[model samples]
Target chain A: MTTKAKRSRLDLRNGRIDLSHGAGGCATDQLVKGIFHRAFDNDWLRAGNDQSAFAVPAGCMVMTTDSYVVSPLFFPGGNIGSLAVHGTINDIAMAGACPLYLSAGFIIEEGFPLADLNRIADAMGAASRAAGVPIITGDTKVVERGKADGVFISTSGIGMIRAGLDLRSDAARPGDAVIISGSIGDHGVAVMSKRENLDFDTDIISDCAALHGLVAAMVEVAGSSIRLMRDPTRGGLAATLNEIANASNVGLRIDEETIPIKPEVAAACELLGLDPLNVANEGKLVVLVAPEFANALLAVMRAHPLGAQAALIGHAEDDDHCFVQMATSFGGSRIVDWLWGEQLPRIC
Target chain B: MTTKAKRSRLDLRNGRIDLSHGAGGCATDQLVKGIFHRAFDNDWLRAGNDQSAFAVPAGCMVMTTDSYVVSPLFFPGGNIGSLAVHGTINDIAMAGACPLYLSAGFIIEEGFPLADLNRIADAMGAASRAAGVPIITGDTKVVERGKADGVFISTSGIGMIRAGLDLRSDAARPGDAVIISGSIGDHGVAVMSKRENLDFDTDIISDCAALHGLVAAMVEVAGSSIRLMRDPTRGGLAATLNEIANASNVGLRIDEETIPIKPEVAAACELLGLDPLNVANEGKLVVLVAPEFANALLAVMRAHPLGAQAALIGHAEDDDHCFVQMATSFGGSRIVDWLWGEQLPRIC
Candidate 1:
């Protein structure tokens, strides 16, 4: 059967998409079975129904969704396909849950190359398999030429929160410690390099990755002591800390010297006149843990590959104004304000 | 509080969306609170977390997703907003489940009017409220102008199916009755009319609606008798029937005269040189039920407002070829094959 399909496969290397791909006809079925199904093959998807029905254990469920409109569909170290999967999985993980299933929806341009679509599906499938999460159900729609970019992917993920784990942004206490999993601004700089056609001597790869495993490892050590976990994707660390401060009604104090950034990424940010503090990092996490368990949580995080450069950057304190202040390396303190406007667009 | 927000409200009437609306900063927060949150206010959404966590009843869970890229975002009787809500809800209902929640992901083009965004969100909120389902969690991303058409919505829905209720397209037996909820071709025609700027003397409205209520009513009367159910949305009745026939390995015989289609919709299909059976109907459903309970199910469906035109248009039978034959009103028999090409693009 595999050989038969391959023999009459789509002209992936040269074929252009047509309206029939989204017409809900035999052509649509061929696209689904020939490409999508072959890549994300799973029992739930093979059920072949309008919806996938399955049993869930009795517990609290967490659901999150993200849309990826990152330009230059193919980027350094990652593409829109992998970013869609990783972004949603990270959202589910932020709640201290075990990410389980994902549903993908794609909007493709009418004349998009079939090869590009196949490559994307393959990448998504690989990411899902690596994370042990399945792409159980999906949808695809095609718009006329120029109506859409090359492709945009929207992924929604559901996960199960284990018993006795309570992680919320508002749970942060004044004495809690703020820890960062790894370096920042890698994802933003990497995508910018490709979109702007800038050449960096050092390879700047996107830090996009699934973080549930790291979250699970940390939970094993500091289950309830952890107050909050956030992946600072869009607004970066500065915005994330500000949000936490407001949500918990506490002030955050950070040391600029303690924050870590790849030298290559820093140079790129400097060249682009962008602030690393406000740049996105797809694979990193910001955690707020009780002061007593901060070291243990950091140790657990560092043990994971995705969190090799973990660092304790700040702590929460009581403040009526809920401000986030950072002690600069130049011996001055500055308020880390919420991002006021767009700094970078389509960086994912 | 409302007055305060309104006093400093976004210039919905004239303001254009900027990349800042999706930058995960104060601007993004304002857009969310002013437009999205205000419209989709609910306890779960109010929590303001990356994901929404909620307890679920123990049962089989059904999940479905769809991406809506319909052109002319606004059309007669419905718009992309309501269509997004109705489309996903119907997908879940087709699996014989009561939709519990929805997660929405939106990709908006920069420079789009804030008024249009608010209107779309308002329509979604209204549709969700009317369907008794909450938009529990969501995400928003913005692309540069020309990177997206205007606004694309991806909705993923989760629903709960009671124990012992099994609905599968492949479960259709040879002796099942084929039933349709209401008039076909309305949605496709309505959207086409708007896209082509062609107005009909008679108002033709898209039949875009949430059909979970109708499904629940029918389930109440004929739970065990239902073999399968589907919404003839994109490829219309022809594609749906063909899919069922192939899936269940059975043959279908339909009487074209029994298939209900609005007069205006039929005339529009003829004017556009399209087949009514191949046009979409957002609010309609195609069900295969045991022949014995067909009348009871039709009675229940007709009692609902969305299914006032319910009719039993066909039946299933054994055939090695798994073909779908239609008896035309002109005393001729023809094969109702799967849609070969695009009938109407971006009709939802």
Candidate 2:
């Protein structure tokens, strides 16, 4: 009867994941205690129960989930680990909530490198700590080789919405001002460069960072004045704006010159024949606020590091068509349509 | 500017999933409205927010998450969809909580059939409705073909524990009686039969079910006397017992003859060279309760539809080694150990 203390340490540097890591046995316990437990290191997780028990504050609760299957698990600036944490946190924060706790589920392909898994866990732990959120409970499963990609992470988060704040997609009004937190297309281009093996003189890094603090700051300054908030992810700014337009039954008018895009991302989009407006951004958020509070909200956003590139890029109007029209730098107007097909796959 | 009402219907019968379905664009909206929305129709889901916001009752909350990558999405008596729902529900119920809401995250392989996806969603919806728990929020991501098996569903569930109940894994005490709700190994054998393409004279159906009602009934009868409860999943009954023994620092003495096993499942396990105690059971639960209330708890469990075959299988004792010893039907004693490796991968 070998106790956990007597078991030898896992071969973290060179060993590959075997079926036992997720078989719910001794090996699985060792993997969890050695890797996941050490990384997450929370009291709730240490309870060793199938579920994490906690107390909920008296307020509206928000819940959201996302699965990260981004290819080339290791991307510039962030990997699937950090992306999984930040993505769900941002989703909850978009509801004007203070992110509370998260639960992670991991599916690892058999023979995946233990070192890589360790790195991903480390990144996830770092991201969770940075955002002041803890991963209270989690599950891990391993599949046969080729039955799964290297690894896929699914994260679900619970948050508490601030009282008196009623933010919803349908809350936008005709006079609302549309603001973006930062440059777009960086996350998509960064992942594409690594996946397609494209190289450029300048580095393109994914803008994957937790935005809950930035959202907290914004909500502090303008609580009910903010109509809605969304993180431009898979379908990017174009899809987000279109969703808002359709949901709110309003039209949007944006100045192309005001939208920020990194030069490397712009060049990559041109070379790849992709629209920068349709590319994803992990760390950026778009907010629609009442006209009177837009400037003050923008000022508050600019004070946060994640929102240093904040800009008011658009405005909503009462148009029967419910279209998102962009005033191009060429002095021509064109509709920013939703992405037609897969511009990029597995970009998280 | 085609509104959702005007958009053409999805080709659910013959169309295959494309990257566009998960692109978070118009196509994604169509998929959501056509399939997910129609299946999981609820006011919170229809709110069209990135996160679902709702009021939670004041109590201790239990949260659990599990990712289902079961091969052959469809199996006898259940599929991955229903299994995903039941598995998480049981996890939360084991903590003596009333399951509340769930959030689903799906990773689909490009070119997968839309019909199958719809079927899975339908099963999930049925399961959610049957359990009285709504899947309020969800996310979808599509990966390139060969990057994913077919579809993997990760579900996170939140439940509210009744006031004054404190269940923990380490709560077992000497003289606690160990009870099992029903026959084990049906789920694992059912999945293995499909995966291995084995035939049997009698049908072996998976015992995947939501156990919240059974737990509630038992809690009503033996509230404080109930030390702990767990569903023997993944590594199965042997692993679950070992976990409890280690956590509570107590030993277990089991009578193998008293443990229930369906003849077909027993035959299947024998033929496959698997131990019945080491196979998964989705609908079953193992409870440790005070000795004085063991009969009352067993009667209550047996009265429930999900626990018709409930039996008292063992008892806890104080031992320095904290081992689980089984008195075999052959009059020999053997230690029950945790599964060393995967008995059957992707068994859910």
Candidate 3:
């Protein structure tokens, strides 16, 4: 009988993934020990159990999950691996929580390059480490070649909510002030630019970064006054505002002039006939705060590097119909409606 | 402006999944509220926040994740949805943890039938409810046609460890007893029978079940003396036993005559030219316990419906090389080595 120590190392440079790598056998063990174990080297993972057991602090815990199927697994600024980490971390951060750890589930198609898989895992590890959140445990499964896109990653994060902070979507009142952390449409445009059909030249990069630090700063300053926070991801600012308005049962009024948009992203959105308001942004947040704390919160947001482009763009008011109305730069007002359908598919 | 109330209802009967349902827009909202909300109805989901927040009991927590890509999603006893929940829950249960909540992430292929999707979600709801665990958070993403086969579900579960119980894969000591909860190979045979290439008729049903109850009973009876527990899912008894042997650095010796195998499963394995020890069983467990408590634990296992056929299969022994040796019914012994490659792909 061949010992595990005598088994061959994975052909990381030239080999490709096959059915056996996920079949819960020697090959699967080797792939896990060689690739995942190397990338996510931590005590919990090294324990090598079906589950990762750890001691979490006593507090209100938040859980969130997101599945990243972004096309062109490799994108500008970050790939799917990094995006998966940031997206789920941001979800926890939206609850005024400090993300503790993450669990990743990968579904890889048969024949995917081993090198690419290694790169993705490394990126995931780097992102998690940078955010101080580790990928504690994970599961991998492989499908037939035609059954899946190259790869898809689903991540679930658990976080500890800050003490005395209860941020809820319905917590916003009629007099709350609305703020946005940064520019919109960069992530969508960056991914779109890489697509084969779009022929636009732009240097836009996806603003995909863990936002817990900025959230921590905001919580430190205005924990009680902050109504809620949301990252405008898939359907962008328009969808986010509409949802907030509906959930809070209040009308939101914003000035389109105050909304930040990079020149390249604006031009690309115009060329592509996509509204900047409806384009996705990965590293932006829409925040609602009490009217009295609006200026202080804005100042705090702008103090952080991630919130350098922060703007107090809107306010909430009583309306029988919870409409998000925007004062357009064209000297006219229009309803910032919820996105009706698919604007950009697979744009994480 | 069209109000949300004016939107048309989702046609659950005849509608097919489209890109818009996963685009995080009004369509996505409708699908979520109309289908998932009604299925996994709970307070956390009703809050409609990006994350679910709740106070958890202070203790060591176990987090586990699994992405289910079972072929022919609808099996005899259960579908992919229930299986996803059971699989992750079992992972946690193996660590003697009481699963608290679950987060589901679904990746669906475009043009898939909404009726089928609803059925899957309902099955998930029913499974979680029956298990006394709730699906507190979830995500949905749709891919282009043929990018995915039907649907894939990834679930993450967090569970609180039972205070005083610490089950580790490497905790098995020499002179410990190895026990199997029930017969093996039922799940694999059941799935393979439904495949197109295989022409066979049998009343075999997949042993897809949540084994938390049995685990709780074992913890109640032999918590301190239990070394470890593992579900023989993918590579079956051989793979699980081999993993235990390698992790604990102890040799395992078992008599083939004592291993529980249903006559039908044995016949099916014989016809398929497969070893019963190498076929998967979703609801079976291979447990290692101290020799003093082996009989007591086996009696308690036999009392549970899920473990009616509990058997004391083997014993761990000291050896320079950690090997799993089994005495065959023909009075010969052979190494029950780790499975080399894919016996059944997508068996989970």
Model 1 residue B305 CA deviation (Å) reads 1.7
Query: Tens-digit lDDT track for model 3 on B1-348?
Result: 564654677999999999998999999999988888899989999888889998987789999999999998988788999899899889989999999999999999999999999999999999999999999999999999999999999999999999999888899899999999999899998888776446555578899999999999999999889999999998899999999988899999999999888898888888888888888888889899999999999999999999999999889999778999999999999989787678889988
Clashing pairs for predicted structure model 1, backbone only: none
lDDT of 1 at B118: 93
- Residue-level lDDT of model 2, residues B96-198, one tens digit each, is 9999999998899989888999999999999999999999999888877887888999999999998899999999999999999999999999999998999
Summing lDDT over every window of 10 consecutive residues in candidate 2 chain A, give the lowest-scoring window. A1-10
State the C-alpha lDDT per candidate.
0.90, 0.92, 0.91
Model 3: per-residue Cα lDDT at residue A21: 85
Worst 10 residues of 1 chain A by lDDT: A1-10
Q: Summarize candidate 3's per-residue lDDT along A1-348 as a digit string, tens digits.
A: 554654677999999989988888898899988888889889888888889999977789999999999998988898999999999999999999999999999999999999999999999999999999999999989998999999999999999998899998988899899999999999999898887456666578899999999999999999899999999999999999999998989999999999999999999998889998988889899999999999999889999999999999989999879999999999999988887679899997
TM-score of each: 0.97, 0.98, 0.98
DockQ of each: 0.57, 0.66, 0.75
lDDT, candidate 2, equals 0.92
Candidate 3 chain B weakest ten by summed lDDT: B193-202
